[model samples]
Target chain A: MAGYPQNPSGYNYGAPPPSQQYYSAPYGVAPPPYGQHQQLPYTHVASPYGAPSPSPSYGAPSSSPFAALLPSTFPPGTDPNVIACFQMADLDGSGAIDDNELQRSLSAYNQSFSIRTVRLLMYLFTNTNTRKIGPKEFTQVFYSLQNWRGNFEKFDRDRSGRIDASELREALLSLGFSVSPFVLDLLVLKFDKTGGMNKAIEYDHFIECCLIVKGLTEKFKEKDTTYSGYATFSYEAFMLTVLPLLIA
Target chain B: MAGYPQNPSGYNYGAPPPSQQYYSAPYGVAPPPYGQHQQLPYTHVASPYGAPSPSPSYGAPSSSPFAALLPSTFPPGTDPNVIACFQMADLDGSGAIDDNELQRSLSAYNQSFSIRTVRLLMYLFTNTNTRKIGPKEFTQVFYSLQNWRGNFEKFDRDRSGRIDASELREALLSLGFSVSPFVLDLLVLKFDKTGGMNKAIEYDHFIECCLIVKGLTEKFKEKDTTYSGYATFSYEAFMLTVLPLLIA
Candidate 1:
């Protein structure tokens, strides 16, 4: 479905103002009202895949500290802050950042993505022939991370900086996932930070979990074109399809 | 579904007997009968995802030229033929093969996969953190490719060495992908060898098409856990989810 551009301009790399630390909101505290942020241009466009309808806003800023630093050399529509981030991550002055650099950079920013997640990001954003991502892809990766961050915070309703099982269910629901309780439990077991005791998911693990679920479900749906829960696969097709996401 | 281990031993790098050129079967000719080949062990185990009963055999061989050459240093269960192929592809003697090497090696074998297909293969089989795939991953890739080759030949019903739209429909169905006519048309358009005029897909393109469809379907199914055929995505989530498979 069509979601509003959560953060059209880009993600803010600078720390949020003290009163607006939505990510670290204390337990039992509600996040700031969504209306407080500046509204983006309201024009809407359908995704090439024909996604439909706007969902609720996840808190996203319309501007960033690097907004005014756009260099003419980059592609148009490139996010300046993304370029800034990419440059910072390209520690070897090689004009590109590999997976190790990406992981270190995100961790530096307190994102702490797993090596797997960083690798997936690199696979998606870079030429698969190489491990490095250039500025153009870094822009897309940056914006996508910001979008996911907004969604994660929206679901961390208790403001404890993590989402418990029920919050995860609601979060997934908003994203159009109607997973069974069994599947939800599986997800919690897969991503839960407390090893199934608390059933709570921190941000990085949540992204990895969601990406895998979404990826696998999509593959199954291709075969289950009639909407049957059941789909068939040859041993090889099954292995080829599942192993990449599961083991990679 | 669980499938007969079509090629449990491994793919044969040596040419098949001249009389059994199944891949180049002329139009209107049937492939060799299924009973003519050596049978693998009849054991069956459910996939972790609980796939169902075995489908028909896909004409995989139970032995290969390199089977007797198993290296002492490799992991157990490692296929000798796959390791041999990996070493041949590792032009730099780096103990691994990168995407370019993979594409070149497949081409040398007359597989002629597209760069994009090679990228996806690398993404699925290798550590995403590096562009290189080690012997262990190469073994999986080799087996998976042989499996896909069997499936592709199975659906090339006319023995024309390529699949047409209707054949593709049947092929997808055999894999439990009951795609609609519109999607079938789209797939043909996406992979057609004659620029959509013939609506035919070569063997290499067929694998790529199936991989994309399978990957995307799996992703969508995660959100459509209720099997509703519809899923919602935040704008960023949508982009992140689809771009990797679509544009990578």
Candidate 2:
């Protein structure tokens, strides 16, 4: 898996802007409409990784009662800012990001969260006992979801919610990476699990693949500081450093 | 293990100064005297990863010869430049770097060679079939050997060829890192295979330990960009990123 930043600044610790702030929304209630995309009312002060903020007055009966950490104006629809963080935490690429990975990913952002605290957060956000949090469900956690939505809309030219190999190539190139065809082909084969060249890449897989490639390329460029087109590496070095970028 | 640069410039690729050059003295013979440190009379152009330059006129009976890549006059004895590269390749903390690691390490210097080529270089340098190459034996390869020797000598304060934990802590501090006592203890426990707290750290281990600590601390500082001094992480993140810096 890709590594996360191990500093507090990596996480946007700024207090939520007033427009996005709301009284702590009780868990599991149909979110009160905050116009446009219905955002869950979340309190800015509550820790993102901990139990939701307490709202004694607005006690909407919730099976898994916990304070909402994200604001009601949390811009809805997938956030791109969360993609790299999500991919780093989604170690296995199973599409179901678990509490362990989430907790670890948060740590990179300098968020201190106990596993129990993460479990509670997961329960509040997911509303079911299932340990895995799918991509659609994860969107409920924050306003940065707008970042993902915007990126996906920009890339999904056909509005199909999935981008194909050619589109993926174009998307990455637009992101300023000169990904070789061989590497692109390898990536498609590795991540396009459905095995058909005609298949469009799903949102989650596309995000994961893009993030991994970008991160690895950055690492390669670090060693190739002289701007050499290629960086020579022994098989072992390749295995230890580069392989993780490719295989994971 | 730490990573190495993959550019010639990354390896300090500038041509050697006139004072360090000498005629090809032929391999396996005592390197013609170059003042205090006997410098290897390597061809100015051989790849750092392969056989000594094949100067047919000099007839250096190389087991597996290759094109000259690095400059002929490799600087002599303990130059500080090679410490990070050597530490990166010394992955296992065995205090003995092997051919595989060396070759990959050279790749970061923009040199490419097959395993057979590395084996031949090792043979010419040590004249032994042993798999492990200690620091003294490894110095025979090139003038850059000066970097490693110089670094080791600088840190081996008592002239015993080993550095104690206090010396290591000081070395890291001088390198501009604020290493905590807890992290230092953990690092010593992880790398000190000899299992004695009173034991002084040998040259290779000291370099490796320092590199690992520096690398991890840098990663932490990246997250703590605000100079907050502390960054919190969940247990899992601690395991994936920070723990590897400590335990690996």
Candidate 3:
């Protein structure tokens, strides 16, 4: 049942450098390989739960024939990187990982990170169709946010600049989260710290926000006393500062 | 790291009764071979956090040393089931299982069917100076609890009929739960459902509460539209329903 989950064995990336140093670097750059992420593009940016409709000025994508999103029994090529990502995404201990499931699986830990925005990024990056996503596909989408913005090659599901709400909703559902237009509204507001109706969510901004959220969450877990990664503040503190936000 | 964190390799356990079906009739428990809990007791009680604690009246053992608690480490060639229980207690993933740590961990997961009055059991079970309990010892304890109502092999380490505020506070810390005396009092009022004057806080009860908290938290997470695992309804329900009967 175990042996790198799925993939041909003996796929060695060669020996790593003896010294393993920490990467305390800032965002926008990739981490050193062997577990760190390099930035790339993705498509299908999730809107807020209550996002405003796009204006007519922003036209739809160009139509072209491409690899359509559908169930494919064909084996993903022998790439260890893609295999690693599959191992993480294929929850339930299953060998094959669907794209939609990736969001739910990643969201569990990602939400553990601080800041409310990772949830938004989680929705954007996950593949909703068939619930499985190969590692090669996931990396480019994750570091770059291919779904919301970026080039057509990454998300051109059928090579179109368009993805639909069902796809986005399934991505959220796989991770046990779904953004209604209401949640979408909140997402857009956070994306637009400037308060302008930015109208569309793009790639670079998505990656920036995702990294910030993750860093903050790691710091927050250290403060939680319950070992469940939550701040165990007293009722008084929680009520005065935190309760209002949840109720709202 | 994935193997027994407490017991390194070189441990032994007979293969499963290939004759036995894995899930057709229960996961099958055979004194938890391979971890520290093998010597402890087992119960079917479904509380989330830890093993169940025994009550005050449970009588002491005439056979084992040090009242009731088992030795942290058994002689080599110990049964696999015994090893399993001991390993479970190595909460921090350290290889050793100390008496203090065992009490906290068993109490943390108090599987309801585990031996009760854990603090007391811990006090009574340390038959050796190493002050630790291995799987054989833990599984034995767990089995005894499941078979009997409660056993005296357990008593608050201090030997008092009940756990006072100070004793309770100290016990909490030794287990990695850093709560204030006030918080402890609140737990007492909530969990010490039996309003006795010297409300002795048994280790089993501590575990019961943690499990309850975890269960409720999980439920709230599922119930919430946001998947944040938060909500006023969940909060009030937890404080009002679970808090009173389990804590101070």
TM-score of each: 0.40, 0.26, 0.21
| Candidate numbers sorted by lDDT from highest down | 1, 2, 3
Task: Kindly report the root-mean-square deviation of model 1 from the true structure over all alpha carbons.
Answer: 16.9
Q: Please, what is the whole-model Cα lDDT of each candidate in the order they appear?
A: 0.52, 0.43, 0.34
Interface DockQ per candidate: 0.04, 0.03, 0.01
| Highest-scoring model, lDDT | 1
The i-RMS of candidate 2 is 17.0
In model 2, which runs have C-alpha deviations exceeding 4 angstroms?
A1-149, A232-240, A243-248, B1-248
The best-first sequence of candidates by TM-score reads 1, 2, 3
Model 1 agreement with the true structure over B153-172: per-residue lDDT tens digits: 98877788888766765565
Q: What are the per-residue Cα lDDT tens digits for candidate 2 across A34-79?
A: 3433221111221122124334432332223342542222123334
lDDT (Cα, tens digit) per residue for candidate 3, span A1-248: 12222223311112121232234221122222323332111111122111222232211121124324432222323336545655676676655454346545544632322222333334333312122444433443443443333322243255432222233223332221222332333333334424434432333333333333322232232333332323433222322222111111
Candidates 1 and 2: which is better by DockQ?
1
Q: How many backbone collisions does model 3 have?
A: 124
lDDT-wise, the better of 1 and 2 is 1
Candidate 3 local lDDT, B42-100, one digit each (tens): 11122211223322222233235673464334534445665666666677666656556
Candidate 3, residue B63: the lDDT equals 34
Higher-lDDT candidate among 2 and 3? 2
Residue-pair clashes per candidate: 19, 33, 124
Provide the global lDDT of candidate 2 against the true structure: 0.43
